[model samples]
Target: MQNDLVSIITPSYNSEKFIAKTIESIINQTCENWEMIIVDDCSPDNSNEIIENYMQKEKRIKLIKLKKNSGPAIARNMAIEQAKGRFIAFLDADDIWLPEKLEKQLLFMKENDLSFTYSAYRLIDEEDNDLGVFIPPVLADYSSLLKTNFIGCLTAIYDTNKIGKMYMPNILKRQDYGLWLKILKQIKSTKGITEPLAIYRIRKNSVSSNKLKAAMYQWKIYREVEKLNIFQSMYYFMNYAYYGLKKY
Candidate 1:
C-alpha cells in the first residue's frame, strides 16, 4: 500500500470559539501521518493566539497569519501553497472529525485508485453536540454530482498527483462547491463513502444557516456560474430543495 502524506488545510477568521476543538480533533486522529496547516485571515479575536499555543505543543500543526481580512478562499489557497502532503484534505474551523477519518478515506482512495473521494458527514450543533444523522448519496459519477453536492467538503480527500491542489475560488460562500465542480471536470470519476466521517457544525449565525441566502448562492452557482439552462437548473434546484426540506 502506498502511504502518502495527508495535509489538512483549515482557513479561519475570528474562530477562537471553536478552533481549539477543531485542532484537538486533528491531534486525536488515528491516521497520524498528517499535517495541519491553519491559515488565520487576520482574525481580530484571539484565534491566532489559541493556534499558536497549540503549535508550541504540536510540530505537525503549522499556522499562517494573514496581514488583512481576506476571505476563506484566499486563506485556503495560501495554505495550499505551503502544503507538503501528497493527499489534500479540508476541515472548516468549526468542524470536527472522527479518529479514523483520514485512515478510512485514504484506504478507500488507494484501493480504488480513485483520484478524489468524499464521504457523508453528521451534523452538529453550536455546542459540539450531534443534531442527528445525515448520510450523503454514494456518488459514483458526474451525473450524480449535478443532482446535488452530496459530497461533504470536510469529508473530502484527494490524490494530489491526479487532481492536484484544490483551486480556492474567489467566491466567498460556495468556494468548496466550486472547487468540487472544477476537480470533477478533470478527474474521470469521483465517489463518496456511505459512512459519516466528519462533524459539520451548523451554527445559528453561520453563513450556511441562512436558508434564503444559501439558496441564492446555490442559484448563482447553478444558473449564473455554471451557466446551466433553465431545465438543468430546475433539476439540480429540486435536488437542493429536497435536501433542504429534509433538514427540518
Candidate 2:
C-alpha cells in the first residue's frame, strides 16, 4: 500500500450485490495514489466473502470486519480511524465513482487549497441503472451548508492536513450530514466540483425515502445537537422540502 495515499473509506453492510462494482470503481480510478479501506459493519449477507475474494487479488484493498452491527456512523468512524492518507475520501459500498473522480477532485482541492470538498452526483437505481443526473445547486460556504446537506458522501473528499478526523454520531441515519456539520465547524469553507463524478444508488426501500423520518433526524441534529433556533429549523425544513420534491 502507498504511504500518505488518498484513503477511500467505504462502510458496508449487506452490500454483496454491489460491493464488487464499488471496488472496481476504485480500481479503475485514473489517479492511482489511493488505498480503499472497506469496513464491514457485521453484514449478515455474503459481503465479507465478496470483499475477501477481491482483497486476495488486490493488495491495495483492505477489509476490516466489525464484531457487531453498528450503524453507518460507527462503521465509517472505524474506517477513518484506520485510514493513513493525506486526503480522506468516502464512498458508500453501493455508490460508485467515475473514472476521473479522484483526478479531478484532487486537482481542484490542491489548486484551491480547500480543506473539504464535494462533487455533483448522478442518481442511480438499485440495479445500477442511471436516472437523470443531479447537479449541486451551488458550491457551499459555511452559511449555505447550514441550510441543507447538499453534499453527497460519495462525492466528498477532505484534506487530512487541515481536518485530520471525521467524527460521526452513532445515530440511525443522517450520520453523513452530521459529520459534514462537524467538519464545517472546524473549517469555514467547503468547495464543490460542479461536474458529476459519482453515482448515488437510491435503494428501493431505503430510509432516505422516508421524508418524515429523515426530517426527524435532521431536526435532532440541528436542534438538540447543533442548537439551531426554530427559524433556522424552518429554513432547513423548507430546504429539505425543496430537495425532496425535486428529487422525487
Candidate 3:
C-alpha cells in the first residue's frame, strides 16, 4: 500500500461560487502526495472552466467532464474508478478543508490501523461566515449508523488498501450514508476524530436544505436501499428525526 498517496473524489455541478476555494484547500494541504479527481456533472455554469484552469497548473488535479448531467453518485463513482491512491477521501465541491486535514487524519488512521475514519466539521453559510456550530465526531458501526448518519461526507476517508474500493449507491441523496453503511458491514467499526477539519457550506436552496425532500430520501434509503422492515424503518426513522432536529 502506498500510504502517502491520498486520492480525493469530488463531484461538482454548478459550483462556481465555491469550487475555487475547495480546490485551493486541497492544494494547501500539509500532505503533498495527493491526487484530486473532480468529476463535473455537466454544469451549466463555468465550474469546469475553473477546474480546467487549476488542472493546468497542478498536475495532481484532474478533471473529468461527463457528457451528460448524471447525479453526484455517478459522478463520484466515475472518480472512484480512476483513483490510484491507497487511501480514498471525499470532499464535496462546495466544502473547504483545513490545511492539516489530510495530514492529521492520515496519521490517525495509520496509528490506529483503521480502514474507515471520519472527523468533526463546522457549518458555514453561503457567505462563508462560520455558523459557530460544529458537529462532533462519534464512533459508528452499522447498527448505530442505521439510526443517524454522523459521518460528514467532507470529513470521511476510507483506506482502499484495507477494505478495497467501495462505491456509493446509485440513489441521488444519502449515497454517502449508504457507502458508510456498506463499509461498516465489512469492517468492525469506523473511528472518529473529534477535531473539526472541514467547512460544510449550507445553501438555502440546496436539496439538503429541504427538510421534506431529505426526509423522503431517508425513508427510501431505509426501505428500498437497505430493505429494512416497516417496523425497523420506523424505529430508525424516529432516531433520525430526533437527531436531525437536534443537529441544528
Candidate 4:
C-alpha cells in the first residue's frame, strides 16, 4: 500500500516540556518513509513555536493549528484527515519512541500480513524514569477488548489499505479505546508485539491517572458508545475492573 509509508498522528496542547524530545525521537527513527502530522489545539504555550521551528528544517513534519482549543479527539482527527500514508500510527506529544520502533513495527505487520498491530511499551515518569513495561494481550478481538483496552494508542498502527481510514469517536476520554473497538469490529483481531518499542510518559496529577474517572469513562464507552445492555455492561465492567488492577 503506499510502499510502507507511515503517518504519525500527534495531538498536542501545552506540551512544551516534552514535545521537543518526542519530535527528536521520531527524527531518529530507523524508518525513513514516514510523515508526522502534528495538530495543535490552541496551545497557550510555546508548543507552536517549537513545532514551527521543526517545520522549517524538516519537510516531513506538518503542523496544523486549530482556530480554537479542542480535545485530543478532534486534534487527532484533524491530523488523520491530513495523513497521506497507508499506515496510520499515533504518538502523543509527550511520549518518546525508540529509534527502531517504526522500522520494527512495520516489518512485523508486513511480514505477518496483519492489518492492525500494537506493541508493548515501558512507562516513564515526569522525570523520564523507567516505571516498568506493560504487556498487552498477544491477540485481541472485539469481544476481549470490550473487557479492557490493551492497545496503547502510542504503540498502535493500522493499515489504511486494509481497513480504510478510521477515526476516533468525539469523546473527551477513551477515544483511543473507541477507535480500537471500531477497528476490531471490522477485523477479527490485532496482533501484539511484546517488545517495548515506545516510552509512555506518566505525568503526576494527569486526568487519565485517576482510576475512578477512567473506570467511569470506560463504563460510558460500554453503555453509550457500544450500546450494550445492563447485564452485558456489568459483565464487561467486572472484567475491566479486574484487568485494570492487573494492568497498571
Q: Which candidate is the best by lDDT?
A: 4
- Score candidate 3 by TM-score against the native: 0.97
List, residue by residue over 1-248, the lDDT tens digit for candidate 3. Answer: 35659999999999999999999999999899999999999899999899999999999999899999889999999999999999999999999999999999999998999999999898888998888656555678898898888888999999888889899999989999999999999996877998999989999987678989888999998999999999999999999999889985
For residues 1-248, could you state the per-residue lDDT of candidate 4 as single tens digits? Answer: 35678999999999999999999999999888999999999999999899989889999999999999889999999999999999999999999999999999999998999999999999999998889999887998999999999898899999999999999999999999999999999997778999999999988876568888889999999999999999999999999999888776
Please list the residue runs of candidate 3 whose C-alpha ends up more than 4 Å from where it truly belongs after superposition.
Answer: 1-3
Could you tell me every candidate's TM-score relative to the true structure?
A: 0.93, 0.94, 0.97, 0.98
Task: Show how many residue pairs clash in every candidate, following the order shown.
Answer: 0, 0, 0, 0
Clashing pairs in 4: none
Residue 190 miss distance in model 1 (angstroms): 2.1
Model 1 ranges off by over 4 Å: 1-3
| Cα-based RMSD of candidate 2 | 1.8
- Sorting all predicted structures by lDDT, with the top scorer first, yields 4, 3, 2, 1
Deviating ranges (above 4 Å) for candidate 2: 1-4
Q: Over all chains combined, what TM-score does candidate 1 have?
A: 0.93
**Winner by lDDT between candidate 4 and candidate 3:** 4
- 21-127: candidate 2 lDDT, tens digit per residue: 99999999999999899998888999999999999999989999889888888888888899889888999999999999999998898899898889999988987
Better of 2 and 3 by TM-score: 3
Any runs in candidate 4 off by more than 4 Å, and if so which? none
**Most TM-score-accurate candidate:** 4
